[model samples]
Target: SQQGEEDPQALSIQEGENATMNCSYKTSINNLQWYRQNSGRGLVHLILIRSNEREKHSGRLRVTLDTSKKSSSLLITASRAADTASYFCATVVNTIQGAQKLVFGQGTRLTINP
Candidate 1:
């Protein structure tokens, strides 16, 4: 079962504009992370926000977590054509044996047109 779901299934924007993606999850998690994947390539880690953290930033990327709402958002400022890709939100789910694994959202596809 998928733990996370992203909104705005698809997004299109002009280069230099900003792109925002939202995610909501069903279960309690140790941390939430965002990843970006270019077509035909593996996902690249963007940022990780722990359950205790409300917000975090790295470069032009910003992430926010709301444990009470069981939601999170990712903001990319001044997006470029190179940034065109699919973005996903993932949650760390703990198992019975004290192990954890990532469950990813459906993902948001962002397109940047020049």
Candidate 2:
């Protein structure tokens, strides 16, 4: 499958702690993005890293991409209870049809306790 795999199916941490998530893909990709989904809701884009970028940071979030290793990682610092959500990694694949689509990983469920 073209979809990527995210490590640590679940995590539980106290507020103010940090959460780190990793992803690995099998095929070449144009870009990789991370999203967060609250329970019973849709996903919200968090960050996007191009194949040419090695690392990026936004607010309390950090994302790293290693195309050579077909892997990526996301780090959230000083997480709050409100940060509880399912985090996903999505790979952008260019198809022969001249279109692109996102193949998402199963995701990592994060729970932050107050």
Q: What RMSD does each model have against the real structure?
A: 0.9, 1.0
Tens digits of lDDT, candidate 1, 1-114: 689999989999999999999999999888999999999999999999999999999999999999999999999999999999999999988889998888999999999999
Candidate 2 positional error at 64, Å? 0.7
lDDT of 2 by residue, 5-114 (tens): 99888999999999999999989888899999999999999999999999999999999999899999999999998899999999988879999889999999999999
**Which candidate leads the pack in TM-score?**
1
lDDT of 1 at 57: 95
Clashes of 1: 0
Q: In candidate 1, what residue range of length 10 has the lowest lDDT sum?
A: 92-101
In candidate 1 the C-alpha lDDT for residue 13 amounts to: 97
What TM-score would every model get versus the actual structure?
0.96, 0.95
lDDT (Cα atoms) of all candidates against the true structure: 0.95, 0.94
Q: How does residue 112 of candidate 1 score in lDDT?
A: 98
